[model samples]
Target: MSQKPRRQKHPKPPKNWQPPPDDKGTILVRRELDEYGLNIYEFRVLAHVARRESKAEGCYASQAKMAEVCGISQRTVLQALKTLCQAGILRKEKNEKGRTNIYRLNEGSKWKHPSELEKIRKAEESQEDELLNLI
Candidate 1:
């Protein structure tokens, strides 16, 4: 007797497909962000920043801290931070006490919002103009 072929297992749909509405409250696991080009590491950092318990004390963490928590190298954390910051998912700030950066979630940031990107571009242009005038 001939044996029948076995079927392959299908992938499961994501439980949480939508991005979190606000960055202040608990953030939804943004699986789509990954699908849209963000890697797992970058998504994790975004989630951590979004779920930060405190903002006054600088809820943002350093690359070293993120590396330790995520079990990745400091270089990887830095790379992820750059990607998230460029994507408008995170805001980076220098810690007053040290050189380490503190990352915060840009709660109002929307990937599809052209105004936001325009604002950033305008700010960069203004800075460039100021520098040129200074020369």
Candidate 2:
């Protein structure tokens, strides 16, 4: 028997991305994550963890389930988890059953744009200048 073609998870966006005003926030998130270093898969993991169900005070997902939802291989999921953890974007623990690893997100951690770093540096410089004048 022949196997069906694999489904493509990240299809190109429509020619026109102008959505109704109500979907503006969702659009913004896609743009922001893209601006950052996250690819579609990475963003999905982050977005999922950011949701109420996933990021509650203490919530986690098994490596198996995460792999299924993210449509990636189990090994790929582990690598992604490592990247997220090193970036201070997610926290993880081994499941008690030893069957899977549990994943969580760090609430305060966020990826900032390169431009934002420049703005922060300029602000700090100005603040230092003002402090020097006062003294």
Candidate 3:
């Protein structure tokens, strides 16, 4: 007997399908998270935390959870987090009950808002003006 063609195990997301919209704070955090000199693991961990951040509550993620999501050991996650906090790229605080840590992204001089891209344009304009003045 001929067998029917097997269906694909998992369907892909539609082209228009997107991850849940990030909160305003997350959008701002994403723009600044890369500025910190983070190794690959740290970057991944911070990105996961930023993705989970809510505008109302900020970022709250556990080391174990980050380890599971990144497929790394909890120790590695902890080290990365420590580095981030030391570098001032992230701020970590114990929760009210001291159960888990809450994280906050440090806003940088650059990429503070959606209009930050405009700052680049302004810089370009000023440079061009300087060149024109020199001419």
Candidate 4:
């Protein structure tokens, strides 16, 4: 019997191949966030903010710019920001000297997981239904 050769998991890059010039910087997102119930727009906005963060300035990108970079509407970006803030996954503060808001990622421990958020929503819905039945 002949044994077949094993395929490489990641093939090597081509010789003399250069990376793209307009490549944006990378963002490090924790694996735990996968269970945080974040929608696509929320995740995209978070990633864009993370990429633009700096030690001195933090992330102060405007909603319009974030929407442009994340390819979503400004209203969607605003809604995502609100949800992230409510979930304690992000902190948004007004810039004292500027109109744009400063955004920072909160500690992972502060984040409410998807399951917990879902439970809360279900409980609220049940309460509303019970109230309607009483009426």
Model 2 residue 8 lDDT?
Answer: 61
Question: Which regions of candidate 4 are displaced past 4 Å?
Answer: 1-28, 116-135
The candidate that wins on TM-score is 4
Q: Clash pairs of candidate 4?
A: none
Q: Give the per-residue lDDT of model 1 (tens digit) for 2-37.
A: 999966333343577776567666534555454555
TM-score of each: 0.52, 0.50, 0.54, 0.65
Model 3 weakest 10-residue run by lDDT: 109-118
Candidate-wise lDDT, in order: 0.63, 0.59, 0.66, 0.75
> What is residue 57's positional error in candidate 1, in angstroms?
2.9
Decoy 4 TM-score against native:
0.65
Q: Which stretches of model 1 miss by more than 4 angstroms?
A: 1-27, 30-35, 110-135
lDDT of 2 at 134: 100
| lDDT score, candidate 1, position 29 | 55
Query: Among these predicted structures, which one has the highest lDDT?
Result: 4
lDDT of 3 by residue, 47-79 (tens): 877778776676777788777777777877886
